[model samples]
Target: MQELKIERLVKRYPGRDQVIAVNHVDVEVQAGEMLVLLGPSGCGKTTLLRCVAGLEDAQEGRILLEGQPVFDASSGMNQPTHLRDIGMVFQNYSLWPHMTVQANVEYPLRARGAKADDRARRAAEVLEVVQCAHLSDRIPAMLSGGQQQRIALARALAPRPKVMLLDEPLSNLDALLRVELRAHLRAIHRELGFTGIYVTHDQIEAFNLGTRVAVMNAGRIEQLGSASQVYERPATEYVARFLGIRNSLAIDPQGGWHAGPTPLAGDLGRLDQHQGPMQLYVRPPSVSVLPADAPAPGPGQIVLSGARVKDVLYAGGEIDFVVELGQATLYATMRVGGAAPRASDPVRIQFASSDALLYRNGQLIDG
Candidate 1:
């Protein structure tokens, strides 16, 4: 497996004082592993991927594949995309309408001067790997969306590139097809042991596919870690909220915050020392909904009594409730088929201190 490294990478488009698309960012990927660049639109994830693919020249820093220099601004060295030994699958399946699936897949191998028999054999092998061998003779216009995507994958893999780059490869498919293709892609990766870097704004996809997920925002990497690490312990409020954290309550200076009628324990004084007003954040799943008649037990627990359920959404494995606590509305989730409270019925919402995260001025406080 080859190691891919980016050292102080930067990309700036020429404009008034230069528009910085990608700032000084550094990342390293181990060979035969999948690393995902995850963020919202225009967060520099795509720019970084293009730089590593040698499709874009970096204005600063360097890119190295297996210790071989691919891009270096100081040395004025930039390899062309075709010579980078990288396969790219774009969001749009760039299949040729004039050519059949077999011809499209064989084009790359043929361009490299492989024998016609060898190219045909390799094309068949890659198409089989992508599970599109059956449709090799069919034109992309006649194929389903998923089938076309698989053909694109087959084409990308036909040349057996050392690095695989995917740019939101499943975004074009339907939800069901996306899930199915995701499984197929992972299985193929395991079979080939290919080094890959995936770029996507979907957090769930990043969590499921990435060996390490790097969260980007405003042309900067906010956090980089394992799936659970980024979800459970985010470095900033942007990361937490982006990951779908819902409940946020103001913190008092006395080291606690009111959750309706109950005070939740937190280090508000320490949080205030940072900047802006102190607030507490909690994920929806972490908030527990108890029976209204339940006994009040334990200290440092924030329990909101008399919260009326405003609405309920039936998710697959859980039920999401929009509960009204006086004038404030909060969301909570509970396991489906376990126990359910009726809508418009009063319920007690309880959450532990450990589940609450402190943030001040849109930034997470170090606890």
Candidate 2:
């Protein structure tokens, strides 16, 4: 079993405009847990992973594996990459075109000075685990993107390193392959019980693959929590927006909601008291269609009485309603055959106030 910890890690690029690629980031991963680092393209997630893999130098900080320090800036002690006992899966498959799948997977064990029998056995075992045993004789150039990805994964796990670092390993695959391989990777993690840190810009990959996700922005970790907590109850305005929550209302201390060009009553419970400036978000799925005859206020319900259905869009399996609540336009996704209205039709929308997440400065304001 392996545990990894990063302390006050900082990586910067010195140029005309000096940029800090990775801020003072700190995180830890327990044995058998996959911690995912998620953010935009330039959010420093990749750099952080690279720093962990010893592929990038850090100006300051310490990294520990199983309580042993691999990097200690104060002591000027940085472990060489080959001695870190880490496995890396890159964005590109990075498989050798000339080598067979078996040979590629055997490279790690071979470099570690394992016997020919040990290398061959380890490579075959990992290839079978990744479901690419049948393709062991083929070269990467003859394989599909998904197959190549499997080969890369097998190669990384062949040596059974203490920790695995994956940097957008599935970003290059097609949509179908990405979905298929996500399940494959998760299952492999469960089977092998290896600690890992994954970096990706795709939300689905982050939420589905990670046991805990760390959302980063501008070289800093904005929020770190379970997938449900981060997605359902985002802590920051940046996180909410990044997660694609669209329903927003700016409210004053008096409970008046500035919902676009109009005003609505906002009952934020404790947050309504002495509020300076606060933003609230209601997830689209939480927004529901109200009956024509108004129902009594249910527990946690917040009703919008005079909303108009501006448009109804059909997208494959679900329908998206472009609802106009006064001057505010909000989107709600519902399954097929729901109580959908035509364009310009009068409609009502309701959602539980508890579902409305409050945030100020990209941080959750718990009531």
Candidate 3:
């Protein structure tokens, strides 16, 4: 097990002008732990990963493996990919078309000058670890996508590299195959306890696989924390809105909002520190709908009437409803076991003060 660290990493392309792909990104991966670099497309996650793998020459920063510097631009020290002792699994399964599975798996060991018998034994062992030993004689074209991926994984691991870099390894597979391969990848990580840095744009995969996820945007890390921490307490409005949070309403500290017969209360929270107008964010599941005839709640809950259900969608386990409150539309998701209201029916909507996050100018503000 070896720890990986990247400090002040910067990658820029100089042509007629300059294009900065990775902007001074710093990342640390604990030994035997999986760290995921997650973000939207073209956010420099892949570029950063390549730098760590010694595949790309970073214009700045230092890459350290197990406390030793592998790359230092100022010192003019940059290790080659093969000499860095890192395994790379690309998005495209980089398998040799003419070679059998066993031959491909044995290639890495052979390059390291292992004996023929030793290479064959290590190849078989790694294939068994990836559960592809039975198809060791099959060529690349004879295997399914998932099977080919397993072979690629086996080849990467056959040499027992100090670190592993996976670049969207499951992105090309179908949804079902992707899910199955994700589970297998997680299992392999657990069994081998190898340091891994995985890059992907899929939030589901990041949440499922990453021990700690670093959310990136526009070539910078927006937030880095556990999955639940990032999801529940997003530091920025971009993260909240991007994560599918739908309910956003502007709030005024001076009691400025008026919705039909109900005047928006000024007692929600103090928005004095926030500049300009303030916005409130709430998850769909936090908002609930009550029957029109139901009595008002006691305290800390805003009760809005005259809301008509605009649509009802029945998902697998939950019933989602779109409700129109005054002129604004809000979504509420209720479990299927609960009673669902009909569309176009007037209902009272309620939400807690704590469930709402206050934001101003696209940034989260303390409420």
Best-to-worst order by lDDT is 2, 3, 1
Instruction: Give all candidates' CA lDDT scores.
Output: 0.84, 0.84, 0.84
- 93-139 in candidate 2: lDDT tens per residue? 99999999989999988889999999999888998999989999999
Per-model TM-score on C-alpha atoms? 0.88, 0.91, 0.88
Q: Give lDDT: candidate 1, residue 302.
A: 63
Which sections of candidate 2 miss by over 4 Å? Answer: 253-277, 289-299, 336-339
Predicted structure 2: clash tally: 5
Candidate 3, superposed: residue stretches over 4 Å from native: 15-18, 256-277, 298-302, 337-339, 360-367
Which segments of model 1 are wrong by more than 4 Å? 16-18, 253-262, 265-278, 297-301, 306-308, 326-328, 336-346, 360-367
